[model samples]
Target: MSWAAGEFSQEEDRYSEVLRRQWGSPTLRGIYRDAYGADYPEEADPFGFVTRTDLARITELVAVEPGELLADLGCGRGGPGLVVARERGAVLRGVDVVEAAVTEARELARELGGEAEFAVGSFEQTGLADHSCAAVMSVDAFWMVWDKPGSLAELGRILRPGGRFVFTTWEPSYLDHRELLTEAGFEVLVHEHTPDWLHRQLAVYRGILGHRRRLADEMGQTAAATLIAEARETRSVLATTPRVLIAASTPA
Candidate 1:
């Protein structure tokens, strides 16, 4: 896909920098692995708080037939989507706004030897052909998009009729926007809080905060500072805000 010179909004540019810096940081990776425990797929190198149970639930919710196409929106590093697609025998198309993330995800896909592709794209503008995918998923990534309505419209545009839409997010709405989903041509199938998400996120944030000095040494000081700041800010609201897993489908 091609892009205009100024196509990316400022938010995308800033997130690109954050993902670029934190992409291959060993310190941060170790923290997440420890936080998530033994079931965590270390090779996949997930970028956020996702338990193995969460992945299995997502796979079940997606319910794609063998050889069908699954789109992973905001698929940072291609871990969660890769695992789900592999479990369901589905092909994978992963999209992210960060170029560095897309590059890393492509490399990971090559290493894992799966039918997967990654591209630099945003939630509001995936650049995917209309009705291209049988199922769509985003793991711990949807909350990053400030324009929820536009992104949902893009999701509706790309997914085929009757396609599944499964995502784990903790936005301010708590994934209870039934009206928004209806307007965007989706029927809400599942919406429930995942309390374990809070525990895992808190552990990860505390781990990051505790390892700031080591993270600074491994990744740059700038990246370490940003992570520390984010951990502090995010953890403050995590306990109060609800993390949710939501499943929806377009009308057949």
Candidate 2:
């Protein structure tokens, strides 16, 4: 990947340190891998809650052209970046805080023989040069950032004039949501709501867990207990959160 000097701000540096610490831990990584898979395969499912449709929509909005330089912020496992690079024949640069995730991404790129590169770093502080990239995108990963304004400003700096910047996030209606792009220098180009089927599927999953304890005799006690625990946690969080699909671009 092309490197730049002193790209991250002080606030970004602090957040990156915290994220790196958490994602770099072996225990936490294992837990995440167990729950989500090595590459988060569920993210690619259209009906899944944290699906890759957001990234797909961003690609459509950005209209990635052949040979374009594309930078993927918070590119977990590099799956979305690899797909975009392969389809558009773009040079892909991916950055993530998790070391193992970065390693997996690099391996995938190598196997696919695509012009892609991966790095272990935070999206808030990627050392990419100003006006160097043709497009910038992120997939379901911006929420962890502590300084939304600084992060978006950095994205603006790296993108060439008139270049596209697109990403997905939990909708503002979601709890713990932050306004990073508006505070920085991006304009929303398009917004697509998730389909009804997706909401229905999520509801089913939630409903099953709500009464999992009562149905423990029918389902295996171990499975029911585990499902109940997971459901309890997910329901507690989702009660106040709603995911969103968003695309934005830097001023031409």
Candidate 3:
């Protein structure tokens, strides 16, 4: 997710701080591992509800060929995109608004020895060439964009003809997500319910609440407090929100 429209710099600084603090918390990592089990990426640290299985599904659905460029929008820490690119033999271009996230993603790519690049960009202004990517993938970050139509249009602009855009996001019942995709000139291919997402996400939140002391020790009180607050805020809608994995494509 990105800032409401013009507040990009503020959100960038804020999220960069969050990433610097949150990524080093062993307690948080444990919470994710405990909740997700083998589904969590051991090397790529992604901040989203898309489990390892969800990522695998994304990898398969993207259908990227070897040497093709795959764009990962809102790519936090660059883990999921790196994993997908490696699995599919694709070059990765990861974009995030957070400078810290882009930094971490670049480091992760170097550590993993993958053909990838990370950039400071957002859903609305991805700095990529038109029709530059064979596929695009986003984890749980798509819903946070305030300018959904514009972002979708940006995705359409960057993706090649017939290229896939696969992502996981939560939608309230009132929103017509498919309509939005169609309006942006994409053909909705698959939109499936991810029933396990709620339970897994709740478990992570509960784990944070349960391990407050440890989290504070590792991530600092302010960061832990922020996580606790977000966990609490997220719990209110986890049940009502519908989690989905969607795959769409540009005109062939």
Candidate 4:
């Protein structure tokens, strides 16, 4: 089903449900393994295809330090969170609305022996303590949220003084996405487009499509069909949504 079909009141519920169902399926796990490799290896970083480049950009803007507390909003499968936790030795906590994704991420954290925590909850209303985190990061999942302003404010609330917040969204040059950070209360720290960013994004989508085909051939038609369907749905949304990378600091 198209993302637009869901009502605002149920958007998180719907997204979490869809992703949970998808991730829980053994067929889908096989497809993910074949397509993205084993849970974003240290060198390979499977999420590299999805959000690695942007995550790098965001990290540079935020400058997280070792032993500091970091929060990852909309932490899909905890790939980006793992990266930061591993790289910075930060106490990382990843929160997502999807229960299955949270479970999967927690399991991956245990398996990888990374010092990271995963919680199933919405970004807007995570029960985290106020002024608790040193940095907050998200990757390509803000569009699914109903209240961007409220979410940003919540980010601000959770950050310690001088804390940084960073995330990547579809660039406006490529899609007609909305701006939600500034409206909430963040002062933008970096707001420049990368070279050939649109081309790079399109290439990643193409890569996903190609991987779906390859997996289908190796795993049989059912697995292939599901991956293809999910990829198509994601492509359709991204094709029309604006993309951007935003980093801001909570005012001290």
Candidate 5:
């Protein structure tokens, strides 16, 4: 599958730099661990759905088994993927466009004692083989794929027949976008909207800005300020943003 370089495709490097700094920060890691029991490598997404409860739900939803290959797209730092690997007893393979994220993911696997592999790659161009995986998932990372159609096609190509695909992501109009999946030929099994999850995530971001002002400032004055403003003005940015704990699978 090929994609014309669009907004997200153009911003790949920018996204990498932003996440590299933010996700690599020790302060943010400590906060995530203390507040969420994420005793793993993570680049905490103040705007993502990656709590223990959510990971647990995804683990069961994906129905991965021992020795199966569980490919994690946008696997940043390996926290979410590691949880699924350990819980489901599946071997994990993660890919991220950010080289730093891939590096951290490798270290994370060693530190956490999980069976996993990591590579620097992108969603639309993941370098895995056709029908190479038993299941594929992305925790709070699907929206980052700029070329939705192309990426979906790539995912479809990489997953074997009957493989499950699950993701926790946000969609402004969750129901209106089901056509994307249908067009990509996925059979939707679950498509539940999660408003409370968005609200809670926004609340967490707001609380972080309030309590970790210094840390936020250190992250980048402009970015932190903008994020804080967005948090405060969540009426549009997040207050009504619907997150989805959606799941789906390909035909056998």
Candidate 6:
């Protein structure tokens, strides 16, 4: 989920630090692997909400072809993108600003034995060719971006005509969601707000963090507590918050 409306730099540090800590913990990794029914990403699902169920929905929504490309933005460790690639028989391209995440994603792609690539890039510039991707998905990463409008423009530039863009993220109650998307040359199709679902996932996340309290302590109590506290905060305001799945298409 999105950390906050304004946590671009702070979000980056938290993401990388948490991911690094989780990657180093075998017990926590095992828990996440079991959660996914034995197929874990190179690391855990940092977002904590994109379960296997969401994976299937996204795969079907994108409707990718065998030779098509799917670009995943803020694709930490390439979990969702890799799964979508495998499910749709589509090539995978993941971009993240974190070098560590990009490295893990590349390794995961190699380990999974697929034609996938990961790059260290920013939200406003992905370094991809124009009109090259057939579909794109960003999971729980867009809110951390400093330039949502520019990022949407970049997605429009890279996506082929009629290419679909799916984003699963959270939005504050105060924003006009459609204005930026429309301004970036997209036709917004569906925006499903599922705050109840998001709240349940947050509970699961808190349970996971509580279950691995010892591991969290080993990593550092401050980090673990910070994560759990954030989850609690989200739960408190989930009624007002909107956990969203936005599907839009590039103009033909």
TM-score of 5: 0.82
Off by over 4 Å in 5: 1-14, 24-47, 211-213, 222-226, 229-235
Better of 1 and 5 by lDDT: 1
RMSD per prediction, one decimal?
5.4, 9.7, 3.7, 5.1, 5.0, 3.5
lDDT of each: 0.80, 0.59, 0.83, 0.63, 0.70, 0.72
Best-to-worst TM-score order: 3, 1, 6, 5, 4, 2
Better of 1 and 4 by TM-score: 1
Expressed as tens digits, the lDDT of each residue in 114-198 for candidate 4 is 6789897787897789999989887767656777677878888899887888776544332222345556666677765543445
- Tens digits of lDDT, candidate 3, 1-252: 222221221233344456667788877888989999988878677666767788789999999999999999989899999999999999999999888788888888999977999999999999999999999999877776778899999999999999999998877756778999999999999999875888898898899899999988998877777777667666766565678999999999
Minimum summed lDDT over a 10-residue window in model 3 is located at: 1-10
lDDT string, candidate 6, 87-156, tens digits? 8999999998878888888887877766799999876889899999999988878767767787888888
* Clash tally for model 6: 0
**Backbone clash count for every predicted candidate, in the order shown:** 0, 0, 0, 13, 0, 0
If both were scored by TM-score, which would come out higher, candidate 2 or candidate 5? 5
lDDT of 3: 0.83
The lDDT-based order of candidates, best leading, equals 3, 1, 6, 5, 4, 2
Best by TM-score: 3
Weakest 10 consecutive residues of candidate 5 by summed lDDT: 1-10
Query: Per-residue error at 218 for model 1, in Å?
Result: 2.1
TM-score (C-alpha, index-matched) for candidate 2: 0.66
Better of 1 and 3 by lDDT: 3
Q: What TM-scores do the predictions have?
A: 0.90, 0.66, 0.91, 0.72, 0.82, 0.83
lDDT of 1: 0.80
**Tens digits of lDDT, candidate 1, 14-93:** 44555777765787888888877876777667877777888888999998998999999989889889999999999999
Candidate 2, residue 100: the lDDT equals 60
Q: Which stretches of candidate 4 lie above 4 Å from their native place?
A: 1-14, 21-51, 171-179, 194-197, 200-240
